[model samples]
Target: MSGLVVHSARKVDADGLVDDFWFVADDGVIIATGTGIGWHAAAQGPGRDVVDAGGHWLTPGFIDLHCHGGGGHPFDDGPEEMLEALATHRAHGTTRSLVSHVANPLASLRESLSIVADLVAVDPLILGSHLEGPFLAPSRRGAHDGAFLRDPGPEMVEELIGAARGTMRVATIAPELPNALESIGVLIEAGVVVSVGHTDADYDQAARAFEVGARMLGHAFNAMNGIHHRAPGPIIAAFENPDVTLELIVDGLHVHPKVAKLAFTAAPGRVALVTDAMAAAGAHDGDYRLGGLNVTVRDGLAVLSGTSTIAGSTLTQDVALRNAVTLVGLDPVHAVAALTHTPAHALGEDHRLGRLHAGYAADAVILDHDWTVRRVFADGVPSADPHCTPARFRMRYSFCQAGLFAYAYR
Candidate 1:
């Protein structure tokens, strides 16, 4: 790869704002960063490529830890479909993402994990895979097919780990299931990040999961117990634990703005803003399905066709960032970190992925004053033109296999 320098920008990252900031990237990593006219001297020499941002809002590229699909495709499909699914999200500034799979037959789930492992070999942007299923509470199996839900038995856990081939990043489990604690230990031993979700577990039950090494509250306050005066619930249990990262879907549909703000305040830097979007995210609102369940998308809200149960959402990280700032009343620095740094830390990649400092990956997003994505870069190369029009494929049964915990019947 060639060298890249983005100059004349107002950069906001972990170190906060820097006026007229400029950075240099060579061989796919940030080499230098400073404020002022130093870039002029660097550009004076040959073999240097530079971009005049004209004072756009620069931020680290958004990292989404929990997303099923976007565009008109879902992650459960093959590689071509996975890339198609991410095109809309990539244009909207999500430079790195984890492919999440919903519940399925054990054999099918193993195949999905191996597929992600292969993709990761070619695309570092494909961080890994996140399993959101097969071990959740049936009572709270929001969109997941109840038939696929099972106990997190040790043998079953080993089967998934072997299939992922070291690329399984996270697995969401309901802690109340029988033998769940032992399964959590086995998953942790294999270096998988465990998350508690889609459960009827109370505060103490959820707390026990956390103590056993589950570090995330999967899409907090949803598919789980709600907080009451006497019952603090799982979300409260997450808040009380400093090591926990609270995943908040700030789409205004899944979580209220006030409630989202409360999470930011309670968890502070521990909140990760995720878009639990399915195939309709950046596509037209219409008929769709998630994992064999018919879904209707009206006004961008996706729900099971015959019921009020939300299947997933039609959201992208750009809209999520805009909402975090405009609706939730958060500072740009904090809001941006929620999208970038927090999630990176949750996945234990903060050393190189989330910050815009020297030695970090040259991943960044240039935003307009209103927070809309204008340009994006990953590994020193600019993405295709931000004015992207995704090819609308005919919605089919294969496309509906978009996965997330609490999905539909298969």
Candidate 2:
């Protein structure tokens, strides 16, 4: 790839935000960064490709650890659909993401994991798979299928982990379930991030899960119990644990602006702003399905059929950033960190994925003053490939059948 010199932009770095800064990158890695008066002159050398941002905001590419689908495609299907779903997110400034799959049958979940593993090999931006179900509380199952919920047995966890081939970045489970603490230990040992979610786990049970290595509170305060004056609930338990990272969906519907602000103050830098979006995220409000569960999207909020329970969100990282700053009243630097650095750390990729530093992956998003995506670069090059399409095909072919009949028949 040719050297890229980005000029005339405000740069948000790991330390803080800077103005009148310039960046130089090659082979998808940041090579140099400088600020102030003569930076524009220094960036005008020959043989260097330049991107004049025209005074846009330049920050590290957004990293989303939990997202289902977007652009009318869901991740519960296959690679074609997964890539399609991811493209919509990329256009919205999510440069890297873990394809989050809802609870499904064991066979389907395994197939999705294998498909995501293959995609990761070809696409560096496809970080991995996050199994968000099949081991959650029935009462707070959210959009997951209640029939598929189960205890996290060692054998079952091993099977899912094996399918991921070490690409299983996170597994959300209820700490109150049988063998849940033990499963947390097993998942942690296998390099999987254990998150406590969709549970009725009180403070004591939640604390024990954290002790056993659960490091995340998935969508804190949504699928779990509320904070009682006396009980304190799982959210409080998670906040007290310094090792834990809290995933907060900053969309005004999933979480109130004040609640989101409280999370930032309570957890500080430990909060990760995730989309937790479903298929209708980048699409218009309409009917959609999540993991075979019927959902209705109205006024940009998704709700399960016949219930007030929120299915997922239609939020994007850009909106999450905007809400953090405009609604939640957080500093742009801390808000950016929640969307970038904090989420990267939660996925155990802080060393590479987050921040605009040398040696980090050349994944970044350029946003206008309104925080809309103007340009996105992945792996040191603009993703101008037309094949980077959204997942819209709702085929019924399973991966096993697709491998047998589709390839063979073709």
Candidate 3:
């Protein structure tokens, strides 16, 4: 009888948008749902709190499978810094995240993983740690420190798995490296979601890796081969695989809008929109360090100090969703799914966290009419002040069709 009930909202989930929807949450799980005044019946209890959404948009909380850092703190720094960064993203609708660390020495990587594991024990929002790591191809090492790149050795894999202490949710590896396939098997066997990334792997090699339990392709078309008339690369390999999820950094800087549209059109529900973000995310653009590599942020784009090699982004999940809708020409429902269920499914958390349904986790984001985050809740607890007025960004509709789409859904 004690719970939180939200009413008078436009609900979006994997199924699509529902008008005048309401849901109730108790003990961190959704317990009931309906449309209209039925929520009034549950609103009378002593321990129940009612949230009048006032015709706002409510969707399941966002899940970011690949995120390095945000709010001027890198995940590799320490537990406090990592938490500080997670707070920033949480305000922008990322309710749960896999803390991603770039390539570092084995000892440093292990230390970071251990710290994240400890945090995971204390914070339900900290899903686990993601190692975008030492097991990368040197040529494809984007923002990762070059000196720390190495082949995925079995001993190193075992050490990392131990360091994470059952909290390693995902690990990125170069599938073409020697012993890489063996390492993929090792990590997958240990319950890690193996991701093919930072690699020179061709179509065949990438397909083989996917066949052997590598379920994710990291940041499509960046730091990897491109699709050509004759050379269909890892992106195509991922597209062809029925079970693979392709991660797209839809910040408009990482991949072109047309190409991103192609990814959405080709992959459909399989595209997981990720913020391969760094320390500069949710912070002012300036000098920063990513995985021990010097990065300069100019015009909101992060790159190696003096090179054109694009580094990680400063994007938050809300902005990525905006780009998916306004820039990449995706339906709002599919864009929300890319941020919610697709990534949650990537980490095998769809059973609880991805949808606004009975028996699901009580995580949600209330967005304004233009898709700006108005409020966020993790486990039914509000993460940011509801009174904080969100800054509105003007949407450029060059690629978007002219229409009154929001009211049409209702």
Candidate 4:
């Protein structure tokens, strides 16, 4: 339970950026935070680990609500491959991540969910599993396996829910499919966040999904209908609903920068910047597989082989943050909040995992002037080395199995 203090930097969080702030964490929990000379006394304390951030940018560790894999390893592979991907993103300041899985057969998906559940039990930073799969629409299934896309039946839905064992944090569904709305109700009943995506759903249908408890739009504007002025698809529908959080892939490929800025303006605090990144992220441009689909990455853009469909992205959170500011013209504080608080709020982990305040988890990232990650602290332990090792914390964030939403689900 050693004490650690980071000071003399620009701190950004829900309170916006503050100059020359300091915070002290004991064990794995933030105990105190202040500004200016208050930290000088702590710096001289015995058994204290003090880091002078040197006026660098400091913010809460990035949280990826939707990410498949990175470092030449897909999450669908297994534990070893998933760990490899986690390590790769961890170095880039993504301290918390939901291991996303592409569409696969029902049996295969259940097995993968079990693997992720086991990992969540051991690794505090692995923030459970997000099933972006089999319950999607065939016509809008971008890189997902079309063969496995099927209607969500009560029995099938219960099986998948049972397989996850309370670790299934998110499930994506196309409201146009048969029983999809009912399935959304079931997932919400099970305390899992339902997202609308990979659908041919029009405005009314998308609106209906959100009204029924679907609170997220997965990588909006890609793999779904775009705004047609008259049509006003899911993007517009999501913009109208205050309860919804729109996931934007700020890689500037899946979504244009101008349109991305529009989302930021329209939704305000609801845009969650996600890296729908595949195995090729943080790796070389080469051939990769997303679920059962083959992908080719060239010029850092991944697309289906011999086709124009963007399979996924080769992006990490650090690059996404920079793109939000430089390419999309968003304020740096808003961009950082999109990476931190917005995603954490989307998954209902905003209670502790997102902000850099007292009583929050000791997780943060230190970025140099160019916004590249210079160091990461997970559970109050410094990951100063480029190589990342898994951290174990006492009060780690996890799926909401405690029924905190008992009234909402009731």
Task: Write the residue-wise lDDT of candidate 4 on 1-410 in tens digits.
Answer: 57889999899876798999899998888888998989988778888889999999999989999999988889899776787787778878888999898989888999999878877776678888899998888899998888988999778988998998899999999999999988899999999999999999999999999999999999988889999978999989999999999999999888899999999999999999999889999888999989888999999999999898898899999999999989999888899999999999999889888899998988999988788888898878775334433322112233358522111100
Q: Tens digit of lDDT per residue, candidate 1, span 8-107? A: 9999876788889999889889989988888888776566778887899999999998888877787777666777787678878888999998898888
Q: Give the C-alpha lDDT of model 4.
A: 0.87
- Top TM-score hit: 1
- TM per candidate comes to 0.94, 0.92, 0.93, 0.93
lDDT of model 4, residue 167:
94
The Cα RMSD in angstroms, rounded to one decimal, for candidate 2 relative to the true structure is: 4.0
Worst 10 residues of 3 by lDDT: 391-400
lDDT by candidate, in order shown: 0.87, 0.84, 0.87, 0.87
Q: After superposition, how far is residue 217 of candidate 2 from its true place, in Å?
A: 0.5
The per-residue C-alpha lDDT of model 3 at residue 100 equals 91
Q: List the residue pairs that clash in candidate 1.
A: 102-403, 143-406, 143-407, 143-408, 144-406, 144-407
TM-score of candidate 2 to 2 decimals: 0.92
lDDT of 2 by residue, 1-410 (tens): 76677777887745698887777887788877777554455456666677887888988889898899988878887676676688788877888999998999999999999888866765678889999999999999989999988888988999999999889999999989998888888899999999999999999999989988899999988999989999899999988998899999999888889988888888889999999999998888888889989999889989998878899999889889888889999998998999889988887789987888778887777888877778877777764222244333212223454353121100
Which stretches in model 1 have alpha-carbon errors above 4 Å?
390-410
- On residues 1-410, what C-alpha lDDT tens digit does candidate 3 reach at each position? 24788999999889899999999899888999999899998899778878999899998999999998888888888765786677778889998999998999999999999877766765677899998898999989988888998888888899999999999999999999999999999999999999999999999999999999999999998989999889898999999998999999999999999999999888989999999989899887899888788899999999999998888999999999989999998998999999999999898888888999999989999898888988787888767643342222111111125321111100
Residue pairs in candidate 2 whose N, alpha carbon or C atoms collide under 3 angstroms: 28-380, 84-390, 84-391
Error of 3 at 178 (Å): 0.6
